[model samples]
Target: MSITEKAHRRSSRSLKALFGVLFATIVLGVTLAGGMSPATAAETPTPAPAPTEESDFTNTYSIGGVLRNGDEVLEGVDITVEGDGFSETATSDEAGEWEVVVPGKAEYTVTLEVSTLPDGVELRNPDAASSVVTADQWLTTSITRSFPMGEDTRETTGFGAQLLQRLVSGLNFGLLIALAAIGITLIFGTTGLNNFAHGEMVTFGAIVAWIFAVLLGVNIFVAMAIALVFGGAFGWVQDALLWKPLRRKGVKLVQAMIVSIGLAIVLRYLYLYFIGGETKAMNVGLSEAVQLGPVRITVASIISMVISVVVLVLVGLFLTRTRIGKATRAVSDNPSLAAASGIDVDRIIRIVWVIAGALAALAGVMLALYRQVSWDMGFQILLLMFAAVTLGGLGSAYGALVGSIVVGLFVELSTLFIPADLKYAAALVVLILVLLVRPQGILGRRERIG
Candidate 1:
């Protein structure tokens, strides 16, 4: 009896000790998860202080652009920017560029003093005497006036000349669409996600460029470069955070597509909130219209078109020739088979996103150049982009290019017959007719049935 009682007492004490330890562990875990003790909380450092108001003034706003008559730069011309309680004047340099900083956000009138002009040269637009510029941020606004060599007279332009002008305009517009559409098609080919939010990427690029080039006064080229890099990074982050996770979870393609639509709505509103509803202009200013045979085109427009064409051609070559480009094509054709063949499927997908983002951003910048930057600018062109993608074939990059050119031409040229407002509608009608006839699109492969 004594031996058994002693053994039982020892066991009871050991059991009590174990239970006491377990209870203490539970209490400690709860405390740590909830909050630190008052003494420890007080010792924690505060977050890094937010930027000060004075720091914001580091970025200054200026008004500037080039003044030219055809190819000749007009130097020594006095350009005056005036507003209530603020005025600044600048002379055009040898390059015909003039710039002057404004006090802050305010409405200012830019006037080209005709008295300061040379004897033979006169402003093309008499009403261009005073251009009212509203500077809401630290941005460089272009106030360019054309100084034609002869007296201002209304000349009747022939139908052929008008058609040629519209054709050039259409080509410029189509090239921009192609840039964005190719990116969309590439992303679709690789991942099979339609990516409705691709339009937001376009908006993002333009906004970022405005912030850097206008707000911070960085060089336009440098700002564009940074925006492109940021675009690529954004693409990577999106794939890593959302698309990759969804794919891992075995989400259906339809669900993913819906998710993209939701994302597009969110991003569109966010852009509106941050960028505001007002249209923002780039610093490139107004380019003088040059006579190109029968067409009169702005120098800026010509340069933009050249850049777009060259870049697109390079992109095409890259897709057909480069190692990564080939890998991208393989993945787009068949992901599982590409993976089985030892390609890094996820890496290829990520690379495609980066490329898509960069291209979309470039397109946004070009769009801003063509029209003023606005919150819904990207969304406005999204339907046209879809038409291009569909007309080209949903998953074919080259097809997107061809389709965008057709859409662009139709949008601009149709204005001759229909109202300019209905040109977009006309393009959609053309898209419908083409699809009805080909079904597989211009460049899409036809599926064979057994």
Candidate 2:
């Protein structure tokens, strides 16, 4: 109330703001510098340290295969993969995994040298020693080729068992999707914008973490934590620089959406410019699988799933119990009324953006762990997020959560009867069917429908 006290409070707030901006700027700079590091680290094309073995290259696309004989993995098998103007050799590790990084998408011939195989291990089919495979561009994780070796009789997993495994896998995927989808819904609800650039937000998280965890050799967990902070900072910056100004300018919803599309294009290409158009992984190798009774999942999958669940639970609590959260819902329901009632609508929207960015970034990190990280990876997931949001009901966060699980399960399980490529189409088909039956979506209130 006193003049000195007011001055002190304002100064403290300014200092805090200054520190926050500094932190955000530093994070952004670190990642941008990382993107440039690879290009600058070498004067010209040169071999990275241990290039033939596990290397510290920023490129992520590869031709990979697993050599196994029924129950036994074949190690030290020399495999060579050659693409246009590119050739690499990889020896199978103890886990039967061998991958040769490729420059980009192209057809390649892969050959397994039988002489290098251990005495007892041999190619099951002499005719299949060499095979040609095609590498897919645009977010294809790894172009996998299979070579069968040796034979000890082991029964194939039953259909029931396979089904259970897929269901669990779908749940794991759904949780991550839920993270991004929930964020999407929050932004859509409060702001009435599709926020297509959100996908880039996802890509940012993965690539940033990839820089720290893989290239810089930082601990994976720490890299992920840093990624989360950057993700939140990204949202804050977007609000302060872009969306808030548009809102103040009385931008039309359609116009604002068009701006997001342009923003998406700019950001995505910027990513490609800095990071190149290759896939990258956040964590090295793979997580060991943990069997849970009838189902098996990787340790990283477990951690990601646990993180998603806990965050969702916290979000639920915040929405239902906290005053700010209740205000958020009120704003989502009707911003003008909430604003008239003394709720800070713009502030609430900014909060929503920050939360959405953090969640989407986490989804991106999880994606890098299981799948491949690429510039357009978030764009791929963005389609599913849209489907989930629409299927859950256009503007409902809880509905988005339920819809994401359904979409994830259907996308994975549909592979049983449909081609894997068609599975995504199948999910969209299901969304169409659901909308036809009940346009409001699962968990959507009746009032949501026209």
Candidate 3:
């Protein structure tokens, strides 16, 4: 054969081989997508996971606020979501009135700023008349607030009256669940161990809080603190006795998770033996209603939300700022490499367990405050916690927070249409959908897992 023709044939053969290699790679990726080990994927930068929906409840109610400076209406004022179960923001129109749509049965507040309102113009309304609005949020209730120029406070206009009550109730429930779910996600993200005993950890927190509040006659805040400390110690002991030894013995992650299941049952029955399966409330009495517009919210529920936010923020800061926290992040990111780098993997793991336990305890106490406490409280929430962890992505702490919030909102908002009994089922449905479409979760990178 001519030299040119032979060279052409060689080139064609090379091209065919390249195509075959590419085809095989695509096949491998499809077949072993989620099964890949994390170490392998770390060599190549993986795509960020897709964002999850924050809330599924669409706005069905509209509230318009008119801001004015003297005779001129202040146009384009920004209005943000305020109060319970509220999300969404808007800007004013040329007429100085800003209209915002919110989910029905949700409570909201509209605040406007004007340049000419004097140095400290405050507004107050005596009758607290709510504005008229349209809503489709749970039960289709509507209310509104109007801010008149020079008035110290605005009067609510056009509301159906019961809208605020429903919003507050839904929001309180959502926040409590979100708190518990965060702890579940945090542990799962770092340990690679599904701590089934987590439910018991929550129970322990509530029980401790109860003991302080009822038996010992301590303040609620102090009781919560005691519960957190005890919970952390309990977690540390569990790591020292059970998980650390199992890990050192080279047990597989799946095996460790199964062992956790056994521990969960044991702890739960022990709780039953002592606490007696009856529901109990914190001893603090709260009968006062703080009414704004058509909504009436209790002081306790408001306190619960503030505490949840503070805890989330402080934990986030600690993880980002402290050396041990950074080390913990590294270990969670990759334990083998972390150990190779001379980091104390065991210590980090212990710390993670303690923190996780503490958070779980705090969450439990807060939840009991929102509702009533029972031995089965944590067990009832276990599945939802798992859903939040999976939905947010397995090893990302912030992902846990985001996932919990998402799940909480989804559960509460779905009740707008479905029966309250089935709201949690909606969260499960969402979890399944997320797994099918993007198993890596909202904040997880789609990399290999060992």
Q: Return the top candidate by TM-score.
A: 2
Which stretches of model 1 miss by more than 4 angstroms?
1-152
lDDT, candidate 2, 1-450, per-residue tens: 999998788667655544454455457657876656656444676565654446535456777888888777888889998869888899999999999888777788899888898777777788999998754443574777888777646657878888998898888888888989988899999999998888999998998889888999888888889999999999998988778866775566786777778678867877776778877755564588888877888888888888889989999999899998999999999999999999999999999988988888888888888786899989888889999999998878889999999999998899888888998899999999999999789878777445
Over 1-450, each residue of candidate 3 has an lDDT whose tens digit, in order, gives 999998788667655544443354356445554554334444687786665577434444556556665566655556665555675666767786667665555555555444333454333443332232333433533444566545544455433454445556666665666666666666665677888888889888999999898878998888999999998998898887667766665566886776778678867765675667678877666435688767777777788878888888888888899998898888878888999999998888888888888988988888777666788888988888888778888777777777777777777667666898998889899999988998889988988779
Provide TM-scores for the models: 0.67, 0.71, 0.62
* Model 1 alpha-carbon miss at residue 139, Å: 33
Please write out the lDDT profile of model 1 over residues 1-450, one tens digit for every residue: 699998788667654544443354456445654563333344678887676887664456677778776677889899888897888899989998888787766888888888887777777776666777765542443333333434545588888888998999999999999999999999899988899999999998888888888889987778778988988888887787677866765566887787788678867876775567789988665456889789998876877798799889999999999999999999999999999999999999989889899988888878877886888888999999999999999899999999999999989999778899999989999999999999989999998989
Ranking by TM-score: 2, 1, 3
**Error of model 3, residue 433, in angstroms:** 1.9
Which candidate comes out best when scored by lDDT? 2
**Residue range with the least summed lDDT across 10 consecutive positions in model 1:** 138-147
What's the CA error at residue 19 for candidate 2, in Å? 31
Q: How many clashing pairs does model 3 include?
A: 26
> CA shift at 401, candidate 3, in angstroms?
0.8
